[model samples]
Target: MHQLMHADLARAHLHERLADAERQRLAAYVVRVAKARRAARRAERAREQAQLRLRLLIN
Candidate 1:
């Protein structure tokens, strides 16, 4: 009975660790995606600004 209890505790601990690792991975992914989105938005703004400047110069 004692051995079985110890085994159960060990399994629970491992499960908790796995869950924590997965959460960390998900958080990292979110950070990467957010960074990419920010970069894309900046690029879009720059392109729009350039177009505006060209139109002004032509006028």
Candidate 2:
């Protein structure tokens, strides 16, 4: 009975660790996605500005 209780407690601890790791991983992924989106937006704006400059030079 003592061994059984020990086993159950170990299992619970493992599950909690796994849960915390998953939450951290998910949060990191969210941050990465946000950064990627911001980079894309900046690239798009830069492209537009470059094109406008080209048109002005041509005209």
Candidate 3:
């Protein structure tokens, strides 16, 4: 009976650890996605600026 209780405790600890790791992993993914979106927006703005300059030079 004592062994069974120890096993249950161990299992609970392992589950908690896994849950923590998953949360950390998800957080990191969100940060990476945000960074990627910001980079994409910067690139788009740069492209637009370049196009406007070209049009001005042509006119």
Candidate 4:
């Protein structure tokens, strides 16, 4: 989480349009975005396994 915030802040601060509060908001945003991405990947793998099982059943 620490790295998350640090990386988040650094990324946010890079944006010329970002203000302080916006940068802080970006910390949470970044964390959530990363979490969502990880969740999506897990879901994708699960879906693929389900499809494989369905294929086996069909055969």
CA lDDT, every model vs. true structure? 1.00, 1.00, 1.00, 0.91
lDDT of 4 by residue, 1-59 (tens): 99999998888777745676688898999999999999999999999999999999999
| Backbone clashes, candidate 3 | 0
What lDDT does model 2 reach?
1.00
Clashes of each: 0, 0, 0, 0
Better of 2 and 4 by TM-score: 2
Tens-digit lDDT track of model 1 for 1-59? 99999999999999999999999999999999999999999999999999999999999
What TM-score do all the candidates reach, one by one?
Answer: 0.84, 0.96, 0.93, 0.61
* Candidate ordering by TM-score (highest first): 2, 3, 1, 4
Each prediction's RMSD to truth: 1.2, 0.5, 0.7, 13.6
Which ranges in model 3 have alpha carbons more than 4 Å from their true place?
none
Candidate 4: worst-modelled 10 consecutive residues by lDDT: 12-21
- What TM-score would candidate 3 get against the native? 0.93
Which portions of model 4 miss their true places by more than 4 Å? 1-20
lDDT of 3: 1.00
The regions of model 1 sitting more than 4 angstroms off are none
Summarize candidate 3's per-residue lDDT along 1-59 as a digit string, tens digits. Answer: 99999999999999999999999999999999999999999999999999999999999
Clashes of 1: 0
